[model samples]
Target: MTDERTYWFDTMQRIASPVLHSLANETLHSDLPTETPPLKPSALLEAFGRTICGLGPWLGATDIPENEKAVQAEFLDLYYRGLANGMRPESQDYMPIVGDHQPLVDMAFLADGILRGGDRMIDDMPEDVQDDFLYALQLTAQIKPYESNWVLFSVLVEIMRWKLDDPAYSQQKIDTLLQKMMQWYRGDGIYGDGQNVHVDYYNSYVIHPLLVDAVTYYSDAYTRSIRDVVYQRAARYAATLERVISPEGTFPVLGRSITYRFGAFHALAQAAWQHNLPENVAPSQVRAALTAVIQRTITATDMFDANGWLNIGFYGNQPTMGEGYINHGSVYLCNTVFLPLGLPVSDPFWADPAKDWTAKAIYGNAPVPRDEPVNY
Candidate 1:
């Protein structure tokens, strides 16, 4: 790799390594409002599992200690227990909760056990555990009738492949979801989070890549036609987002939980990894811009305690304003910063430290003239 490329990889490694290292030490308290109000441990488990899975690559054998394995094992064991405790589906406001969120929890664990982290835990699952997971998927198919968030629904399709691989898991529902989700597309790689037209980076960072990944996982059956269209547009959108960083290396910081500002880089990272980055897009530039944003938002004194509990609020120590859903362990969702784990070391993009994006072009690159106001 050239010195220029090496710079970007080094910078990304720096920005991500600390967050992954912090995971083992982060305090996970369950008595907090995040767990008390809704009183559902599965959501917390899902959030925690996703965080761990997102950060796992960085935490591989060499980075994390062998001693920490027991801790992580216990953490996962508790989450699995929660899934076992309430395997049935529920509904809310006439919408199927299975389609809305519960399935997401089921899929999160399923992915945690099989697809995302590998199938190491597959054989270890008790017979009853395997049966409950199947029952959960059956419930997932039943709830597909009234759901609208195509992203969450798409997860079930991937989980089906990973869990059952059965041709009987409802291809019709998957097709319906793809059709509905495509309706949210406004071109240039953006998809509305759900109904309506509120546009933001979350769609770019979370929704698009997740859908694309789901598309890729089922490539054996679904033709490449659908995946190609979404990937091309997503890469283009990532290219446009490259211009969002200021010459000073700052983003607009325009959405909810500015704490999640760093999480926005996950989409760009995936684009680079997939080798689908736009022609005009430079991985080095995305790295430099993203590194700058992390430095600005994730202050050592504010974002985490000495013990590693991610402090609430965007800039300071204020857990009071966090959602009723943010518990001690939930804060580690911030580890979504390391979503670049999917990228292999052999990838040219990760071979170097970050380079500059703000040098040649001034401040007018990827300007969003107007941002949609999100209801807090």
Candidate 2:
């Protein structure tokens, strides 16, 4: 494997092993550190679901190297066992999917994982486990999401339902939520978190990724135009994400969920994974940029605890960086940076020669293309 790919896979295993291993062994509740007891239940779901979301594409790919595939097989076993344990009421690590508002968010991440993982996430599981998994996901219908980005969460869950042919899936709900999202579009590849604009990474963190994935799955005459516009905006926003990465791999760190680290590039990573990057953004440049960010962020001294669970911080263990809603499990969203790992090693994204990203080129006085805003 190339160094960047190796580093990404190794780091992913490092971040995910503890959560999946403990849950698979039914020891997650006891093993995971819950500095904030009230958030513990939701936090557990956050870790598992978000980890799967980031790992889904990689998990589903069939053309990976043999060594990587072996490791993937191991993790797949743990994922199935973890799912069984997390949904079983009798198990100590059982995660509640039907309570409070937070599960609405994480369940969407779980659903996104299933969607990205494709058939591998469901088709390979035991029938009983599959039944339990779908049942747990269906329970999210009881929790009403807020009108903001949370709307996309519900949309994603429904999309997953549609993909699985679950009877509970509602096309009406998906269409309705998607229409609401269109109203929030503030032009220039940006969407207000809801009705109002907020300067944050939620666009990358939640809105764009969810909308793009949702419309991609449920495409029809009703969604065809929406898909065209969403993908156009997504490509534009992805270009913006690429430009923001500094030569040192640091970004502006503007936003509420700053503690999610490299997840700020979810749109960029997803673009590469889907081969949807704008014509101006070379896949090799994106690979270099992302590899730099991953190194800078994960190398922080206290990014993880003694036991390997991620700590809350933009840089290190800066608890002050966390919002009231942030918790240990929440930081696992950083795994989204690994989305391109879903592509095969032979794909140009992995095999191409490295090149400087926009920022790096500008900082080094190298000739670069003119920057322009997307008029869409």
Best by TM-score: 2
Q: Which tens-of-lDDT digit does each residue in 89-172 have in candidate 2?
A: 899988887647898899899889878888888877787877777787688866788989999998888877677679878888
Model 1 agreement with the true structure over 1-376: per-residue lDDT tens digits: 3433334334434433333333223322232224245535444343444454454333332223343356445544543444344342331111122525454543543353244343434445566756666665655555433333445444544455446554566555555566677777765567776666554456654566566666765554553557877787678666666667666656665554344445556567567656777665566566566656666665546665654445565555667645554444444444454544445444555556555664325544543223232211
State the C-alpha lDDT per candidate.
0.51, 0.88
Q: What is the lDDT for 153 in model 2?
A: 94
Q: Estimate each model's TM-score.
A: 0.68, 0.97
lDDT of 2 at 290: 96
Model 2 spans with C-alpha error above 4 angstroms:
none
Please estimate how well model 1 matches the true structure, expressed as its whole-model Cα lDDT: 0.51
TM-score for candidate 2: 0.97
